[model samples]
Target: MLSTRRLRPSKNKPKLPDGVRIYAMTDIHGCAHLLKQMLRVIDADLARSRPRYAIEVYMGDYVDRGPDSRSTLDILIDRSRRGNTIFLKGNHEVFLGNVLRDPSLLTDWLRVGGLYTLMSYGLAPSPTPGDEERQHLVQAFARAMPRQHLEFLRKLRLTFTCGDFFFVHAGVRPGVPLAEQQETDLLWIREEFLKSRQNFGKYIVHGHTPVRSPELLENRANIDTGAYATGNLTLMTMQGSSMLAV
Candidate 1:
């Protein structure tokens, strides 16, 4: 059965009362149907003022796994153009960056849901073009992506802090100021973040590790939840220190 469970607000992240309601979602992979439904839920929530969180975000892995990555990106890009959207770079986005920088890595990337991107772009079963054609295909694909999406992907913050919350696609390195956190940590670190005893100062919310449900805790929350094949996208909302999931 399709779930429509109601989530209560969290005490750590606050909701916006005067402006947008501030909704954050993670790891869509490529499930377009759930993306559509989530968008509807956000809109409907805002329209009815039901716990009211308006700003919507997708915390990476927007493509791959599912068959509708292209359409999924289309919806995100369109909604983003209208304003009040935040798209973070998940490990999958990192894969895109890597492939564009060096197509030779396509084989490795394809093993982790990247095959969908090549197929979406109408490419071959084998990795990608060889020495002579790499530049052409890479440049074309780069140019084809929406400028804003590229900019968003490129400029994504390693760590984002608002109120008492800190967010990264993965987790940050231990014992480092939020400003000094490394890119490798933001895009990859997992075990260190999970094992650290000292508080990283703020509640870190991340989405690198996949889970069946939103992993909410005092230190960090893993919201990846593998939505691509399951057709379920998990989102955690913060309203004035109260946490809620939709």
Candidate 2:
């Protein structure tokens, strides 16, 4: 069931710097079309509102599953150059980096939409590539990936923190201090972190689990609306003590 409802601000709001506003979105999964649309909306909104300080935070999974993965990265890279933007690494991104270092992981990556990402770069690998073919494909991918795009992916942040919000790709581990959280948990934790109702010190703004709608809980806001499959690329904004989604 696709959720058509808009996300409302949570009761436990945290104040950001007086003039700063954050526009955060997540789990793009190569949905370049939706990404483009959302950016336009955000830009228009900012222009209309005239906020003093604006920062864009992307919660990762920029490649695979949807069409135009390469184009998706291109858009993000270009956008980052234009202004204040932060990109975080998702589990899929970790998998991609690992596969690039070790071709044997290619089959595993493909099982979870890595093939589509390759297609975006115009490299079509055989379903069961032999050792030689795998190496060849790896080389091809290295050659095909734009230098800036590769650097962007390599330098993606694991977590970003603002006044009272902790932004990560996935939820943080329960009982762990935000500063002490492990990289693996930051990029991949699910059930343990999701089910916990305990205070995480600061509200965690994340996207990984695909909820039907935006999960605007007191402790976290999950804005990953599953754009790759659902066509609903959600964006969450936090300004001062208020949050909203469109």
Candidate 3:
């Protein structure tokens, strides 16, 4: 069955260009099943709405945690090839790349669920890998990772802007201008961005810090529903000045 929840209209509703629709998603955390389910719902919604143009903005964290990280990337890569899609980099993805480049970071990466991702690529990661083991694991991962997947990860964007919304994996820095925002803050910031009431130039649509449900604040919207653990993956659809969570 189709699932959707209309957002309560805010006084100053953000608008999209006429006839364009955006389906924003975030924080899959390697849950391929949930991602597939959400994609089906988006497809159904698109069939019914048939807007002039549509864009799917993925807020990243597509790997790590849960299971099936490989399949998750497979699905997303395929989707991107099919049509209009924007992929943003998330902190977890940063960890993946960092560990690949510098094996010394494996211990830190494993703590935040990088093991699952390694396992999904058919490499069994030791819970506490030593320096030598870390190097071996990284080598194995490089061999196991598909060329396309590596390319996709390397090419991910930090932000995507469309009309009145700025899409990112995590919240932007509170005081930084959108163009001047740093990559670290864009992919990792939380407290300051969430706590501040400062108006970002555009309506911020992001995910990284998962919420019990989708939050549609006057300034921003968070669509991360902790899909890996809670089995709730959020897809926020935006068109004109209306937003709906599915």
Candidate 4:
């Protein structure tokens, strides 16, 4: 694990274009209903403001620990088709892809909320799946997953930047230059990123570590709000330096 203490501020920072309003959401887990409600709120807020342009950035963790992973992905896929949106990859997604490729990893996946994800696809969740059973589950998932959802997961971005804000699935590694941070850290870092107050050049907005409420820090903002467990999904509205949860 990387050290979190005595971190320094970043030098390379990028800003979002002028007059652009962005709605950044993170860590839906498998709460499709919450996601739908949040989107409606965002749409209404955007319409009231009427910015020159708007973009929706989803910071990933679309599945696991919740009842509707399949429906959540379906909603996100449909939303992507309607307008501008950016989908990011979370640790859960990485695990999902890995299990799809190597069934042996299913045991580890199941321990960390993958069972719910499997159930969402209408597949049986087993502690010890035989070779034949593993193959059947894989095939079932393949058949259940829509083409667009597969593409969405396959092409999910690791990081996104807009007007002085950097977005990632998880927090960035402290002390490492933003451009040089590793994918492993970006997707899975916890204490190091959470404990450090070092300026990451841009305000990093991320989700992975769930919190009871949104955490606003000098370097980053954690908006996960544990939607899968808490039923409170956070949707943040950002315009220049002004930001608020709707």
The number of the candidate with the highest TM-score is 3
| All candidates: TM-score | 0.82, 0.95, 0.97, 0.90
What count of clashes does model 4 give? 4
Candidate 1: list runs displaced more than 4 Å: 1-20, 50-54, 127-152
Question: lDDT per residue, candidate 1, 1-246, as tens digits?
Answer: 345434442443433344335677777777778888888877776777664335565666777777767677778878887676766777778888888898667667778877676666665454654655655666666766667657656765455566666767888788998888877788888888877755677777788788787776556777777777566687676666556676
Candidates ranked, most accurate by TM-score first:
3, 2, 4, 1
lDDT of each: 0.70, 0.88, 0.91, 0.84
**How many clashes in candidate 2?**
0
- Cα error of candidate 2 at position 115, Å: 0.4
Runs in model 4 deviating more than 4 A are 1-16
Judged by lDDT relative to the true structure, which candidate is superior, 3 or 4? 3
| Local error of candidate 4 at residue 143 (angstroms) | 2.6
lDDT of 4 by residue, 1-246 (tens): 111122122433334678998888988889999888988887887779999989999998999998899999999988998778999999999999998898777778888888898898888857877778877887788788878778889999999988788999988988888999999999999999899977878789998998877777667788888888877888887776666774
Error of 3 at 103 (Å): 0.7
Return the lDDT, model 4, position 67.
88
Q: Candidate 3 lDDT, tens digit per residue, 108-137?
A: 999899989999999887689888999999
